[model samples]
Target: MSETDRPRPRRRRPFRKAVGLAVLLAVIGYFLVQRASNSGPAYCTASATGAGTAGAGTVQTYEMTHEQAANAATIAAVGISKGLPDRAVTIALATAMQESALRNLDHGDRDSLGLFQQRPSQGWGTPQQIMDPVYSAGIFYDRLAEIKGYTRLPLTVAAQKVQLSGFPQAYAKHEPDAAVLTAAFGENGIPASLACSGPAPAAGDPEKVRAELARAFGKEAREALGAGRAGAAAGRSKPAGTVSEAEVGLRLKEGGGPAEARRGRAMAHWAVARSKELGIVRVSYDGSSWVAGRDGGAWRGKGGEGGRKGGAGDPHDAAPGEVRIFVARATAH
Candidate 1:
């Protein structure tokens, strides 16, 4: 009975375990690739700040430290003028202001760049393309425009279409910022000021700016951006003087390296974010401030050092300002 009942103990098939493990690994790899291809998740605050006013059935505002409004407005204007609808502009502004405060940060979700924090590896564009505000914004709009119904798409949906962000819903909060920019820069809407409040443009070493761009792109964070765009490894090199507008634009286009662009964009947005309190009627970069009757705008030069009227101290200090969003005055319709 023992001999018959003990008929060959069933042999354990270790290969089955091996096959199971292999399948598990393959699934994990698939998801990893998917996340990597999607440009990763957005770093955002869960709560809302009253900085921006609600409109068009939306009740959210891009959460920014006191300094992101100007940058958000500028980014929104550029996006809208580039043919992106108000919704797209709002998503882009919120993403930038929240991720890098509308700065063309050379950093982000693993080698993401520019105002929208697009990653070159994720097919947003090259690091250079992602860094250039126009190019970057254009790329974002290109993606956004492709959405089936982007204009009517919710802020998060439109942004997710363009960004492929892991946190797909994060873009909802920036609607207010986009709306504000729309009202200010729309066809005949009131103009809200935009400016920079960081270290005044000086004849300092330009290389430093380059480095900052890299850092903002998440280089400082040393994020693991697998197979980044070819030229993305190189850090931005500042020339021996104050960076020119062309240079700034170029750096933004180049992307990758240190995130100097992010820092610059941050300062610019911070100024815009605080414009009302600072009484900043207009803001300009390596280029010009706004002029009502001039085709060519004006760049604030060394002579414009004290350009910030309300005694804005070091921009990095995160000082509070007097102005708040006057929604009624700044609305478009």
Candidate 2:
């Protein structure tokens, strides 16, 4: 066979090696694109202008995942329902930030679980109960209330009293984030302060809203709504069921006092925080409004009546005592 004859022993091995390398590179590129596409935004930020009422002030902001933000809101709601002040909320938030970074984990160090990293063996709850954020938060507060002036203690000290973390000092570093979350989620912190970014969740179920309200507030919510209706009837006559189909109205007891207003705001914010999960589109109370996927998810003054312009004149405005929630129509899906 001549040097160039005998079919050159074929270039098959080199061609196959090149093909394999190209395939490997293509696979790597595909995975890289997939990772980029699947990864969500690194963080979500929420901000509020005024401290509480319907006025403008320096904007206070906090950044976290939607899950973290939602969990923070739940923790705050649980505290407020118990009449625990913002201080208590701050302490709880700080502890959670240190323990589980505000995530409701199914597993943790040993048997610890949920937001507070509570231990089942340590008597926090069963593994299942500790994994429920609301139940865990309630028990955390129950212990905190026994701390004898927990509100007066330093942030780390108070959180340590509840968490009993070996590294108690670690909580202090989270105090700033915890305070920001408390201010955004607490009743007295601000109205419409917590705003989320990204596409809104599916339309919320009205029945679910009612159930969650009752679950979070218990008898207080039902009693307040009834008292509010009675007061409204006594004050002046209005047509029944005047609210639009898209709206769900919850009236706070007219004479239920400041606590009622506080509860109202707490529920309003709760609905807003869980808006994506619950499919709530708009939440309005005390003349301020928050609409999902609007104004960067921040609260704005109710234009005309509804959060949107030219609606049935703001169901909330007509019944100032109520917290009005607007959900997307099923057909709109």
Candidate 3:
């Protein structure tokens, strides 16, 4: 065949194949990103101010991931266990907000890790210990308590004494947000002020919730709720209208007076704050109730009598004595 007339061998379109492969990979990447974004825990924001009443000051709110909210709850719980006042919690939270943004990070300057960014080399704790939100929070409080006048000191000064950060002033800006969180978490006696908005967490185990409660609030709180009890006396209590030990919840005694009532409210708010993480569905204290995945997800009136004796028909109407926490079953979530 003449050169011009010769049939050219069919060329393989390698470029086309490469383009097809690239497009396929791009589609897969996009879907993976979307799935990851959707499957992770939902973001929640809460706030409280003034008397934590409807007309409270400016009503400042703060936004954070569910993880941050949960950690904030633990911090508040631990501080309360140590008998630290609300001011102490406000300072601790503001410091954490400044140090780690309320996230338990595994990295920071010069071996700093976890919330508050304490350095192991400086006696914060072992890396693993520091990474634990509870331990780290305890350590933070332990040091704060050592400060001669942490409670009366300015927030910045109190936080600076514990954190010793180069940017001491940074903690001040977070004070407002910290205050809101502290109040919502019951540091200032405002139960049900904090509410989370999202799909309820995967069904949570009440046993696991009990263990976590013990870890955060101390063993006495869990024991008081009849956790790990076996005999008739184990879970059974004589409190009027309170849930029995066999029930899948905790009923804190309100008869202990105002101090005890305040403690009950603190625990109740902590449970609500951690509902997303612990699979908690409802928390009732004083005369209010918070239900996850209900009524656009906010605290609402239970509308009955207040106290343990209140009928189930009006869970919110219970009087101000004990707090009740309900965890959703695995299948329920």
Q: What TM-score does each of the candidates earn? A: 0.41, 0.74, 0.74
lDDT for model 1 comes to 0.42
Better of 1 and 2 by lDDT: 2
**Model 2 per-residue lDDT tens digits across residues 89-189:** 88898898888888898887888899999998898889888888889999999999999988888988988888888898999887766766776764463
**Model 3 bad stretches (over 4 Å):** 1-41, 51-57, 189-192, 227-247, 303-320, 330-333
**lDDT of prediction 3:** 0.71
- Candidate 1 contains a number of clashing pairs equal to 39
Flag regions of model 2 displaced more than 4 Å.
1-44, 48-59, 189-192, 225-246, 304-312, 315-318, 329-333
Question: Quick one: ranking by lDDT, best first?
Answer: 3, 2, 1
TM-score of candidate 3 to 2 decimals: 0.74
TM-score of 1: 0.41
Report how far residue 218 has shifted in candidate 1, in Å.
30
Off by over 4 Å in 1: 1-74, 187-333
Q: Across residues 206-302, which tens digit of lDDT does each residue of candidate 1 receive?
A: 2333333333233321221122111111223444442322112122223532223333333333333433333332333333232111211122332
Worst 10 residues of 3 by lDDT: 227-236
How much is 33 displaced in model 2, in angstroms?
Answer: 22
lDDT per prediction? Answer: 0.42, 0.71, 0.71
Q: Write the per-residue lDDT of candidate 3 for residues 179-226, one digit (tens) a residue.
A: 887777665445336666666566666777778888888854775577
